[model samples]
Target: MVTVLIVDDHPSFRTSARRVLEDAGYQVIGEAHDGQSALAAARVLRPAVILLDVQLPDLDGFEVALQLTADEDAPAVVLTSSREGNEFGGLVAASRARGFLPKDEVSGPALAALLR
Candidate 1:
């Protein structure tokens, strides 16, 4: 099974995402509401994929992605955001994130596909 780490500030979003991914045959190993916790979870859990919110309290998704990517066994980071702008696009291009998705655009199958 693919282990997933969900990093989002909203409780509803995190619960919903966990249900969706779990239903789609993905194992949710950890969840974090802030970037700092996300990084800690990533280090401990070492999930296969990280569904991360770009606007985190402690650190931004790009910073977390950079730190994770520097690790020897970094997991793939999929940035999630509601923002739609050129600046976001540029950040994604420069970061270590594997992909970016709008918060509402994500579906269980799509997330599963990303893991695959």
Candidate 2:
């Protein structure tokens, strides 16, 4: 099973995502509400994937993705936003994130496809 870390500012989203991913057979190793904590948790937990939110309190998801991907054994970062994918344009393609997922479309199958 793939281990996952969920990073979002909203507690409800985090809780809901944990359920969805877990239900899909992914192991939810940890969660973070902001970019700083996300970074900290990623280091400690070392999950296989990171479901990262774009509009983080401390830093944006793109920024975080870049930082994480800089590491030699970086987890696969999948960027998520409440906004549509078109709004981000080339930002997602430019970042080191495996792909971008609209928050509403974040499901286990969708996330697994992105990792592929």
lDDT of 1: 0.84
Per-model TM-score versus the true fold: 0.90, 0.97
Question: Taking the tens digit of each residue's C-alpha lDDT, what string does model 2 give over 17-98?
Answer: 9999999999999999999999899989999999999899889778888998888889999999899988988999999889
Q: Which candidate is the best by TM-score?
A: 2
- Give lDDT tens digits, candidate 1, residues 8-61: 999999998888889888889999999889888988899989998889988877
Alpha-carbon runs more than 4 Å astray in model 2: none
Q: List the pairs of residues colliding in candidate 1.
A: none
- Each model's lDDT: 0.84, 0.92
Predicted candidate 1, C-alpha RMSD: 1.6
